[model samples]
Target: MKVCLVGSSGGHLTHLYMLKPFWQDKDRFWVTFDKEDARSILKNEDVYNCYFPTNRNIKNLIKNTALAFKVLKHEKPDVIISSGAAVAVPFFYIGKIFGAKTIYIEVFDRIDKPTLTGKLVYPITDKFIVQWEEMKKVYPKAINLGSIF
Candidate 1:
Protein backbone atom coordinates (compact mmCIF):
# COMPACT_ATOMS: atom_id res chain seq x y z
CA MET A 1 0.00 0.00 0.00
CA LYS A 2 1.21 3.50 -0.65
CA VAL A 3 1.64 5.57 2.51
CA CYS A 4 2.01 9.27 3.03
CA LEU A 5 3.69 10.02 6.35
CA VAL A 6 3.24 13.64 7.41
CA GLY A 7 4.34 15.59 10.50
CA SER A 8 6.44 18.47 11.82
CA SER A 9 10.25 18.12 11.80
CA GLY A 10 11.18 17.19 15.32
CA GLY A 11 9.24 15.10 17.79
CA HIS A 12 6.33 14.69 15.43
CA LEU A 13 8.67 13.39 12.76
CA THR A 14 10.35 11.08 15.25
CA HIS A 15 7.03 9.64 16.33
CA LEU A 16 6.13 8.77 12.75
CA TYR A 17 9.61 7.40 12.13
CA MET A 18 9.20 4.99 15.02
CA LEU A 19 6.57 3.24 12.96
CA LYS A 20 9.18 2.23 10.42
CA PRO A 21 8.37 -1.40 11.05
CA PHE A 22 4.87 -0.74 9.74
CA TRP A 23 5.90 1.43 6.79
CA GLN A 24 9.31 0.04 5.86
CA ASP A 25 8.07 -2.27 3.13
CA LYS A 26 5.37 0.01 1.81
CA ASP A 27 5.61 2.53 -1.00
CA ARG A 28 5.89 5.63 1.16
CA PHE A 29 6.83 9.30 1.16
CA TRP A 30 7.12 12.00 3.81
CA VAL A 31 5.68 15.49 4.22
CA THR A 32 7.49 17.50 6.85
CA PHE A 33 9.47 20.63 7.58
CA ASP A 34 12.69 21.22 5.66
CA LYS A 35 14.80 21.17 8.78
CA GLU A 36 18.05 19.54 9.81
CA ASP A 37 16.45 16.70 11.71
CA ALA A 38 13.97 15.91 8.95
CA ARG A 39 16.72 15.93 6.33
CA SER A 40 18.88 13.68 8.46
CA ILE A 41 16.14 11.20 9.31
CA LEU A 42 14.54 10.96 5.88
CA LYS A 43 17.63 11.30 3.69
CA ASN A 44 16.85 8.08 1.84
CA GLU A 45 13.13 8.69 1.59
CA ASP A 46 10.94 10.91 -0.56
CA VAL A 47 10.30 14.17 1.33
CA TYR A 48 8.07 17.17 0.73
CA ASN A 49 8.60 20.27 2.83
CA CYS A 50 5.51 22.13 3.97
CA TYR A 51 5.18 25.66 5.36
CA PHE A 52 6.00 25.89 9.09
CA PRO A 53 5.48 27.89 12.27
CA THR A 54 2.05 26.50 11.59
CA ASN A 55 0.65 26.88 15.07
CA ARG A 56 -1.80 29.78 14.90
CA ASN A 57 -0.07 30.95 11.71
CA ILE A 58 -2.70 31.65 9.08
CA LYS A 59 -0.25 32.32 6.27
CA ASN A 60 1.59 29.02 6.57
CA LEU A 61 -1.67 27.17 7.00
CA ILE A 62 -2.94 28.55 3.70
CA LYS A 63 0.38 27.76 2.06
CA ASN A 64 0.34 24.24 3.41
CA THR A 65 -3.26 23.70 2.36
CA ALA A 66 -2.20 24.49 -1.18
CA LEU A 67 0.82 22.26 -0.85
CA ALA A 68 -1.41 19.48 0.44
CA PHE A 69 -3.67 19.70 -2.56
CA LYS A 70 -0.73 19.44 -4.90
CA VAL A 71 0.99 16.57 -3.10
CA LEU A 72 -2.09 14.48 -2.41
CA LYS A 73 -3.21 14.80 -5.99
CA HIS A 74 0.20 13.75 -7.22
CA GLU A 75 0.86 10.94 -4.77
CA LYS A 76 -2.67 9.58 -4.38
CA PRO A 77 -1.55 7.57 -1.40
CA ASP A 78 -3.65 4.76 0.06
CA VAL A 79 -3.16 6.13 3.55
CA ILE A 80 -1.99 9.31 5.28
CA ILE A 81 -0.57 9.24 8.81
CA SER A 82 0.82 11.77 11.26
CA SER A 83 1.77 12.62 14.82
CA GLY A 84 1.48 16.31 14.37
CA ALA A 85 2.19 19.90 15.34
CA ALA A 86 0.10 21.64 12.71
CA VAL A 87 1.10 20.61 9.17
CA ALA A 88 -0.99 17.44 9.30
CA VAL A 89 -4.26 19.38 9.26
CA PRO A 90 -4.18 20.20 5.57
CA PHE A 91 -2.89 16.81 4.47
CA PHE A 92 -5.51 14.89 6.45
CA TYR A 93 -8.36 17.06 5.24
CA ILE A 94 -7.26 17.02 1.65
CA GLY A 95 -6.32 13.37 1.69
CA LYS A 96 -9.90 12.55 2.65
CA ILE A 97 -11.13 14.26 -0.47
CA PHE A 98 -8.70 12.11 -2.42
CA GLY A 99 -10.28 9.04 -0.79
CA ALA A 100 -7.18 8.16 1.21
CA LYS A 101 -7.52 6.63 4.65
CA THR A 102 -6.30 8.95 7.42
CA ILE A 103 -4.63 8.08 10.72
CA TYR A 104 -3.76 10.60 13.41
CA ILE A 105 -1.61 9.63 16.37
CA GLU A 106 -1.88 12.06 19.19
CA VAL A 107 1.57 12.99 20.51
CA PHE A 108 2.78 10.99 23.50
CA ASP A 109 3.38 14.05 25.65
CA ARG A 110 -0.18 15.26 25.91
CA ILE A 111 -2.08 12.89 28.16
CA ASP A 112 -4.59 15.28 29.69
CA LYS A 113 -5.40 17.38 26.64
CA PRO A 114 -5.49 17.14 22.89
CA THR A 115 -3.10 19.07 20.72
CA LEU A 116 -4.58 21.63 18.39
CA THR A 117 -3.76 19.56 15.34
CA GLY A 118 -5.28 16.49 16.95
CA LYS A 119 -8.50 18.32 17.73
CA LEU A 120 -8.72 19.68 14.22
CA VAL A 121 -8.25 16.36 12.47
CA TYR A 122 -10.14 14.12 14.91
CA PRO A 123 -13.49 14.46 13.24
CA ILE A 124 -12.19 13.40 9.87
CA THR A 125 -9.59 10.78 10.77
CA ASP A 126 -10.31 7.22 9.77
CA LYS A 127 -8.40 5.92 12.74
CA PHE A 128 -7.56 8.10 15.72
CA ILE A 129 -4.77 6.65 17.87
CA VAL A 130 -3.80 7.84 21.30
CA GLN A 131 -0.50 7.18 23.01
CA TRP A 132 -2.00 7.25 26.47
CA GLU A 133 -5.16 5.71 27.80
CA GLU A 134 -6.15 8.96 29.45
CA MET A 135 -6.25 10.65 26.09
CA LYS A 136 -9.22 8.46 25.21
CA LYS A 137 -11.27 10.53 27.61
CA VAL A 138 -10.34 13.62 25.67
CA TYR A 139 -10.96 11.83 22.40
CA PRO A 140 -13.74 9.42 23.12
CA LYS A 141 -13.46 7.39 19.96
CA ALA A 142 -9.68 7.22 20.00
CA ILE A 143 -7.99 3.85 20.15
CA ASN A 144 -5.51 3.53 22.98
CA LEU A 145 -2.35 2.16 21.47
CA GLY A 146 -0.23 3.38 24.33
CA SER A 147 3.07 5.17 23.68
CA ILE A 148 4.85 5.01 20.36
CA PHE A 149 8.02 5.96 22.21
Candidate 2:
Protein backbone atom coordinates (compact mmCIF):
# COMPACT_ATOMS: atom_id res chain seq x y z
CA MET A 1 0.00 0.00 0.00
CA LYS A 2 1.22 3.48 -0.76
CA VAL A 3 0.74 5.60 2.36
CA CYS A 4 1.31 9.30 2.87
CA LEU A 5 2.24 10.20 6.44
CA VAL A 6 1.36 13.89 6.80
CA GLY A 7 2.02 15.93 9.91
CA SER A 8 3.98 18.86 11.26
CA SER A 9 7.43 18.66 12.77
CA GLY A 10 8.28 18.01 16.45
CA GLY A 11 5.88 15.70 18.28
CA HIS A 12 3.74 15.07 15.24
CA LEU A 13 6.77 13.86 13.30
CA THR A 14 7.86 11.80 16.28
CA HIS A 15 4.51 10.09 16.48
CA LEU A 16 4.53 9.38 12.75
CA TYR A 17 8.03 7.93 13.01
CA MET A 18 6.82 5.44 15.60
CA LEU A 19 4.36 4.06 13.07
CA LYS A 20 7.06 3.72 10.37
CA PRO A 21 7.91 0.19 11.34
CA PHE A 22 4.41 -0.96 10.58
CA TRP A 23 4.82 0.18 6.99
CA GLN A 24 8.41 -0.88 6.47
CA ASP A 25 7.48 -3.25 3.71
CA LYS A 26 4.91 -0.94 2.18
CA ASP A 27 5.54 2.16 0.10
CA ARG A 28 5.22 5.17 2.39
CA PHE A 29 6.00 8.85 1.93
CA TRP A 30 6.35 11.66 4.46
CA VAL A 31 5.07 15.23 4.10
CA THR A 32 5.79 18.13 6.41
CA PHE A 33 6.96 21.73 6.38
CA ASP A 34 10.56 22.28 5.30
CA LYS A 35 11.99 22.66 8.76
CA GLU A 36 15.50 21.52 9.70
CA ASP A 37 14.38 18.90 12.19
CA ALA A 38 11.77 17.57 9.80
CA ARG A 39 14.27 17.38 6.96
CA SER A 40 16.88 15.67 9.14
CA ILE A 41 14.57 12.91 10.31
CA LEU A 42 12.99 12.29 6.93
CA LYS A 43 16.25 12.52 4.98
CA ASN A 44 16.43 8.83 4.20
CA GLU A 45 12.79 8.58 3.21
CA ASP A 46 10.60 10.07 0.50
CA VAL A 47 9.59 13.52 1.75
CA TYR A 48 7.45 16.32 0.36
CA ASN A 49 7.83 19.89 1.55
CA CYS A 50 4.63 21.91 1.96
CA TYR A 51 4.43 25.43 3.30
CA PHE A 52 2.46 25.90 6.50
CA PRO A 53 1.02 29.23 7.55
CA THR A 54 2.05 31.03 10.71
CA ASN A 55 -1.52 32.26 11.19
CA ARG A 56 -4.38 31.96 8.70
CA ASN A 57 -2.51 33.78 5.97
CA ILE A 58 -3.78 33.94 2.40
CA LYS A 59 -0.35 33.55 0.84
CA ASN A 60 0.20 30.34 2.71
CA LEU A 61 -3.19 29.11 1.64
CA ILE A 62 -2.24 29.69 -2.00
CA LYS A 63 1.10 28.00 -1.46
CA ASN A 64 -0.58 25.06 0.23
CA THR A 65 -3.07 24.75 -2.60
CA ALA A 66 -0.25 24.52 -5.12
CA LEU A 67 1.66 22.13 -2.91
CA ALA A 68 -1.44 19.97 -2.49
CA PHE A 69 -1.74 19.67 -6.24
CA LYS A 70 1.90 18.70 -6.54
CA VAL A 71 1.50 16.05 -3.86
CA LEU A 72 -1.62 14.59 -5.36
CA LYS A 73 -0.06 14.40 -8.77
CA HIS A 74 3.33 13.01 -7.79
CA GLU A 75 2.72 10.77 -4.78
CA LYS A 76 -0.73 9.42 -5.46
CA PRO A 77 -0.77 7.59 -2.15
CA ASP A 78 -3.44 5.00 -1.51
CA VAL A 79 -3.83 6.02 2.12
CA ILE A 80 -3.07 9.07 4.24
CA ILE A 81 -2.41 9.07 8.01
CA SER A 82 -2.02 12.29 9.91
CA SER A 83 -0.98 13.26 13.47
CA GLY A 84 -1.03 16.97 12.98
CA ALA A 85 -1.40 20.56 13.95
CA ALA A 86 -2.24 22.59 10.79
CA VAL A 87 -0.59 21.15 7.69
CA ALA A 88 -2.79 18.09 7.93
CA VAL A 89 -5.85 20.09 6.96
CA PRO A 90 -5.01 20.51 3.27
CA PHE A 91 -3.54 17.04 2.92
CA PHE A 92 -6.54 15.38 4.53
CA TYR A 93 -9.05 17.04 2.24
CA ILE A 94 -6.90 16.46 -0.82
CA GLY A 95 -6.52 12.81 0.09
CA LYS A 96 -10.31 12.47 0.43
CA ILE A 97 -10.89 14.17 -2.91
CA PHE A 98 -8.47 11.71 -4.48
CA GLY A 99 -10.41 8.79 -2.97
CA ALA A 100 -7.63 7.71 -0.64
CA LYS A 101 -8.36 6.12 2.71
CA THR A 102 -7.74 8.77 5.36
CA ILE A 103 -6.76 7.98 8.92
CA TYR A 104 -6.53 10.58 11.67
CA ILE A 105 -4.59 9.94 14.86
CA GLU A 106 -5.32 12.44 17.58
CA VAL A 107 -2.10 13.85 19.00
CA PHE A 108 -0.74 12.53 22.29
CA ASP A 109 -0.79 16.02 23.81
CA ARG A 110 -4.54 16.28 23.25
CA ILE A 111 -5.72 13.94 25.94
CA ASP A 112 -8.05 16.39 27.63
CA LYS A 113 -9.27 18.27 24.56
CA PRO A 114 -9.58 17.49 20.89
CA THR A 115 -7.22 18.98 18.34
CA LEU A 116 -8.94 21.08 15.67
CA THR A 117 -7.75 18.81 12.85
CA GLY A 118 -8.97 15.78 14.74
CA LYS A 119 -12.45 17.21 15.04
CA LEU A 120 -12.52 18.59 11.51
CA VAL A 121 -11.41 15.39 9.82
CA TYR A 122 -13.41 12.98 11.97
CA PRO A 123 -16.48 12.74 9.78
CA ILE A 124 -14.53 11.96 6.62
CA THR A 125 -11.74 9.88 8.10
CA ASP A 126 -11.77 6.16 7.53
CA LYS A 127 -10.26 5.52 10.98
CA PHE A 128 -9.85 7.70 14.05
CA ILE A 129 -7.25 6.48 16.53
CA VAL A 130 -6.69 8.08 19.90
CA GLN A 131 -3.90 7.60 22.39
CA TRP A 132 -6.07 8.42 25.34
CA GLU A 133 -9.19 6.52 26.29
CA GLU A 134 -10.72 9.74 27.57
CA MET A 135 -10.86 10.99 23.99
CA LYS A 136 -13.54 8.42 23.24
CA LYS A 137 -15.91 10.64 25.20
CA VAL A 138 -15.34 13.42 22.72
CA TYR A 139 -15.19 11.18 19.65
CA PRO A 140 -17.20 8.07 20.35
CA LYS A 141 -16.14 6.38 17.11
CA ALA A 142 -12.39 6.66 17.79
CA ILE A 143 -10.36 3.55 18.49
CA ASN A 144 -8.05 3.70 21.50
CA LEU A 145 -4.58 2.68 20.43
CA GLY A 146 -2.89 3.67 23.65
CA SER A 147 0.20 5.49 22.31
CA ILE A 148 2.31 4.50 19.34
CA PHE A 149 5.31 5.98 21.12
What is the C-alpha local distance difference test score of each model? 0.94, 0.84
Report the lDDT tens digits of candidate 2 across residue range 1-149: 89999888888888888886777788989888789999888888988887775236668767776777788778889998888867777778888888889888999888879887788788988999999999999999999999887
After superposition on all C-alphas, the RMSD of every candidate to the true structure, in Å, is 0.6, 1.4
lDDT for predicted candidate 2 compared with the true structure: 0.84
Candidate 1 matches the true fold with a TM-score of 0.98
Question: How many Å off is the CA of 134 in candidate 1?
Answer: 0.9
Clashes of each: 0, 0
Please, what are the lDDT tens digits per residue for candidate 1 over residues 36-70? 99999999999999988999999999999999999
TM-score of each: 0.98, 0.92
Task: TM-score for candidate 2, please give it.
Answer: 0.92
